[model samples]
Target: MRRETDRTMDFLDEYRLRPDPADPRLSVAVTGVNEAGEPVETRVTVERALTLFLNSREIVTMMTIGDHPEYLALGYLLNQNMLRPETPVTGIDYDDDLGVVVVRTEAETDFEEKLRKRTQTSGCAQGTIFGDLMDVIENARLPATPLRTSWLYALTHKINQTPSLYLESGAIHGCVLAREDRPLVYMEDVGRHNAVDKIAGYMQHHAIDPADKIFYTTGRLTSEMVIKTVRMGIPVLVSRSGFTAWGVELARKAGLTLIGRARGKRFVALAGAGRLIFDQDLAYVPDEGARHRRKGARAAEDAE
Candidate 1:
């Protein structure tokens, strides 16, 4: 049998982008007290402000973990409808000292009107949507992709076991872009929206097709999450967390398959149930072990 460490290495080898939890710049060590009042040291995620600029016009400033600035800038603009998908990008300049990223396009673009309208979303670290959320996805036609139960089990197990910032620190949100049972890219941030935007930016940069991909998150399946998934053109969205009412309603309208509370062998499909294929037998599927449980899972258990 292959060693667990080797298995992890092989899984990580397939990722085009994954978290670097060991990076000193991403986190810092601090002394704290445990439940019993014993002094303990732990690493905490570091947040940096990144101001995005679309040409000479300044856009929103977001709090992030300070990785993948270019992707974040591009993704944020793309999702906000400020940057069109077909827009030619002449350059992306990121200044580390000033903490700013500028995305230059072939044509002059202005979103002063869109910037005036913003809606605060429920995502962690304060997420904002610049325009009508339904305008972009109103005519979205998601492909009828079949998601197998076997692949779902494989993905959840592998993702939970993968070493990440959430496992390293106590707080963070992760978003993964996966194909079948193999996870392709994993991005984490202070806000779930930032993580999703990072994946979007990566896809935009690589010209990757999202039709065959599955989107996974460690955050709640909220309306923002659903909108972003539909905007990315991914048919299925899954999470190890629960769902929201608007999230479920929007998923059904968009024909996007939404699955949540997906830990171990159990899951609840709130929308697009027609796309699920029950290929895996429950008898063979083991329960999610404690060792592989994420921070969200542990918090749920503690509440129960």
Candidate 2:
């Protein structure tokens, strides 16, 4: 049986998912003076769909460019902090007739109640609030190890070079989960939130450790994004874009090392500097006057 992530591979995989052996249309234009800059036109067929579902009897729908629906569903729950060991995820089934996903969980609970209790905050593009999961972030902890800048750069480059289904279709977002700088899971969706949820779902299903790894995204570091990373207990969060003020503040409070504008060999540290290590063999001089005064005072006090 294929997992949700596997079902998503129609876009992620090089193989075609359309049984009819067809390709989505592409757009082109002739803008040149026979090859010089002139008037041109192009056309392309893009894929889009409304994914609907009944959770606790409320109809929830997400608009997405078709790719990785299973992982999207699973990742949605995990990233939203709705997954529990005993919350039976009966099955995720697709209904072609209804054009929706049928998610069967173990028991029926007050889902709307759970959702309302969460705080409402916005993020880059389309995003939702996380009303009830703040405590989870505050209590979460990661290892006290130093993260080298080399590995951070390697991870950013890997994200840039990843094979994305969205780039092919020109309309989806991507999210990746990594361990010690190597990507272990990658996903894409029309919705950035959905892509994140899929990665979170994959981690939950596999029982992966959040403390030993990082989460990378093409999305900006919004408060909602911070909440998701915090929920996972992951120590580091990096993105190719920028961060909002609140996101950085929450990251600092949670002791998470947030990296933004991470590309090539440069990155901005928004919080938790203690977790990062400067390159070895780099030389720096201590402030002699200040150091001497402090050390001398300590030595004289100890002698007394």
Candidate 3:
């Protein structure tokens, strides 16, 4: 018992976070006020309730923009500890009109007890973490990857310039699965967790390796976000937002490389700093451009 306890204690000390805006593909028309308080007609993010059914039993409803419902459903089940990694998923059925998704697994499954074990998470849109969920943290092996400042700079610039739902519509969060400085998969939703789950689901479905990847977000580095990133076996997390006390603590325990407040050429990493290679010169790194910057984003005026 002492040896097991010590291992768990060591795990507890290890830890991190890991975008995006209104995508026209996911936005709707609405009237809103501008910075000057002038009435303007434009598009706004569209969010709706999506009910998920695992095989025959109803699971839970989520509020999302519905980009990848299949991925969201599978990912949610995986993260909630309801679906084991080796479980064979037969098929995922989604009915967009009814806003319902059903994930058919090869093996018999039930979630009544799992649902009862859920605890509220800090994620927006009512995220839930199940009992024993954290146990998966022990087996999630993140690769010892190196993060360079040059790659960080290039990533931030490209993401800013990409025309997204956030640029057109305002109230949405983006998550990206990136390699080097290029984004491989970009997902957005009403809640940041949902966005992350979609990416997780996609990665799982396609058997994408997390070893050489980085996770990026436009939201805060909260504990929920950090836990998901760690469970996904992602070693590095970058956020344009700041971190929470518990969030930082968790990352440190999990040995996650946490980078937050990543805007333009500026950022701060609290844990796993050894993974960061500061290979870029500040003078050569360009500040974020105006049009690409999010509304109310930290300006480069000081660097101006």
Q: Give candidate 3's error at residue 57 in angstroms.
A: 1.6
> What are the TM-scores, per candidate, against the unseen true structure?
0.92, 0.73, 0.86
Best by lDDT: 1
Report the lDDT tens digits of candidate 2 across residue range 1-304. 2333333423234222211112343212223343566655532224455464535453346765545566666666666655553476778887655657766686765566666765556743446653466766677675555677767766656555554454343445567776655666776655667667777766666556576777888777988888888876778888866789988988888888898866454478888777887662323312123221234344644597
How large is the C-alpha RMSD of every model relative to the true structure?
A: 5.0, 12.4, 8.6
Give lDDT tens digits, candidate 1, residues 225-295: 98889988999999988999999999999999999999998899999898899999899888898876766
Task: Name the better of 2 and 3 by lDDT.
Answer: 3
Best by the TM-score measure: 1
User: Model 3: what TM-score?
Assistant: 0.86
Instruction: List candidate 1 stretches off by more than 4 Å.
Output: 1-16, 108-110, 294-304
The residue ranges of model 3 lying beyond 4 angstroms of the native Cα positions read 1-25, 32-38, 108-110, 292-304
Residue-pair clashes, model 3: 19
